[model samples]
Target: MAVTTAPDRAATPVRAPAHRVRRRPTAWIFAGPAAALFALFFAYPLGASLLQSFTAEDAGSTRWVGLDQYRRMIDDPVFLKSLVNTGAILIVQVPVMIGLALVLAVLLNQSWLRFRGTWRALYFLPAVTTLVAYAVVFQVLLKTDGGLVNQMLGGVGIGEIDWLNSPTWARISLILSLTWRWTGYNTVILLAGLQAIGKEQYEAAAIDGAGTLSTYARVILPQLRPIVLFCVITSTIGTLQLFDENYVLTKGGPDDATLTPVLYLYRIGFQQFDFGYAAAIAWVVVLLIAAVSALQYLAFGRERRR
Candidate 1:
């Protein structure tokens, strides 16, 4: 029979190893200040905004009014108009820009292309350009009289356009400016995705006698779906949050044509001193962004499974 034995504790006191706290605490020590700052700045403001959205101010005192502010959005014409305007941009601009970006990405990925870095940089420049300055420059270029765009049109025997003054044109101008600024950024991003794919995929497709367009349509672009989804979702968010371009170019326009939710939020908060209503609008925007992003993710997931 095998004998099992336990150490006799009566012989000597068993000293427990000093239960020193793990050295891993150094990481938390370093991260503590950053966490504190984030809570102070981002988390606190975010919580405050959500709380503020539920209350209204009167006689310089805030009072809780629950969903009344959100309900007000339903009957608010300007708010509805802003939503419609943002939706229009989302529908029209996002796809067009993504498509253009895909084409540029493909072109950039071509082995025959020269100075690829230079081309990429040139395209990305607009995305990083000073926002207000770029908008001002567009405003100058788009002026109805003695403007560069009008001068060019006159040379082509076309009449001057009141780009910022007309509702339709104002929206169009915003779209054009947005496309100009962002297309290259999306192109660079998509190009990175394309480069991640192996060249053998292309070779295999070519060996199967697939034409260039057919191969990309049936094979390469499908593989790029995730990157394209990212671009689309981001662009959609940008469209929804549009303020700087429209604000500087047209100040929400001659007839509120370019009014975006963020611009409306600014007006309500700063201009009208209706901070609660502004907070409500902001939360609505946040919910919208979350909902739209979730839908896109689910959709992309389903499509990819196929």
Candidate 2:
């Protein structure tokens, strides 16, 4: 009764193709608009910028000039200064801002922390604040005489400081402004990373005689590696291409001390109408960012491996 003939057994029916059940043509129809917009706005601009680097102009008329504009960039002193300033920001500001953000994120993500929503809102306020408004407000606050910053210093018996007038101080002021503006954004990212961590893992660590410091160092940090790398890479790129704050706050002033690469590029292309040179600068910035991103990936990849 249990034995069936081999010929009586049949194979399972073939399933229909995945595409037969769902229409891919309809999906593409929806994606077409976004793809077109991206190609036109992002891809086109990047390609044009690259091509324009080799383009030349005769009294506001553009023409091809091969690599002449790039060659000129090699010897431009202001270009060199801008490079130095941008490099300085990447080296100093990026780490400081990211570190501050990480700390803030841990604090905000703490389970025992009270009024978490209110605190997060306060910290994240600067991020959503208009860049132009912040720049204008800071400019007024940093004024040498009768400004909020100087007035606060006067209360502490410290003399008024010319924050935007002095070269070193102006650079510091720019760095501070950049840090204040972006740290919250990074904190939000890192907090999300912290929240995504498994609660059971953390609890188990505590049960195994792990203190707060040990839990954070061993369990939390290792899990957060990817997010930290993301913040570092993005922050590095942003700092390298710093423009808006410097343009509005200092106008790349105080003897070009705070002049960033992008600011210099703007001055060349828009202010001086040197489109070729600006494109060259833009290309160099792209290369620099790529190199830095690669180095960071390598370094962090190795760290993760260990």
Candidate 3:
């Protein structure tokens, strides 16, 4: 047969496998645009902001001042007040919201709970609501004269108190609004963590003669450390970055009572046109967030090595 006279192996021209194409160029082809965009937008802006922070504008000219901007923050009363306000919210609002969320989570996780999905959605609605609309509604509700909240208080014989005008009441209003908006979100997260735990563990605790509250405190909550830590860390960070709610509601205040770092940054950068100082403040906030988040991780992330 003619097949018996097949061409010699070496003499047969080698055809490179079609599938053996170089992949490196293809990867770069896909990644090059994204890389370029990131460099242009994120990287350039970050480096520029950092460089600008070390320089001060003099006689309409930029001159390097080397830490002068950072030093300014130390003695700036508005800046210090902003820090204090942020700290207060971090300490008070975060714990209260988290505690309420934990309670709601446990209650919502109960097997007897009716229309659980509906309840969960209802609770979470505030989180997904339009920010502008939410802000406007809150403004109307918190208005000093003839507001919804004031009218309600008046009906109850509680004299009309300025909800958003007085510094103390403004802070309180901010905290209450923050809690109202975020507590449900945290509740959903904690509830997810609770549900992930099987009923078998609950039964195991029951067999060990543990009461319901003790069961949760001793058995369940211990396992939920990671989730709780997540909530706390996020809430802490959010408090640090607080601006929108305070801005929309109080414009950072009657007396800067709710003026957070970011809102302060806005004022410094935009209103005052002190971009270098603002950049310094921004970097400080970034560092503070990193430090606080690390500390919280160490504090709440502890677990027995198993």
Could you say which candidate leads in lDDT? 1
lDDT, candidate 3, at 64 = 96
Candidate 1 RMSD computed on C-alpha atoms after optimal superposition onto the true structure: 3.7
Off by over 4 Å in 3: 1-21, 302-306
lDDT per residue for candidate 2 within 31-95, as digits (tens), equals 99999999999999999989999998897788888999889988999999999988887788989
Give TM per candidate.
0.93, 0.89, 0.90
Which regions of candidate 2 deviate over 4 angstroms?
1-28
Model 2 has an lDDT value of: 0.91
On the 0 to 100 scale, the lDDT of residue 165 in model 2 is 95
Candidates' lDDT values, in order? Answer: 0.93, 0.91, 0.91
**Model 1 reaches what TM-score against the true structure?**
0.93
Return the candidate ranking by lDDT, descending. Answer: 1, 2, 3
- Sequence-dependent TM-score of model 3: 0.90
Q: Over the full model, what C-alpha lDDT does candidate 1 score relative to the true structure? A: 0.93
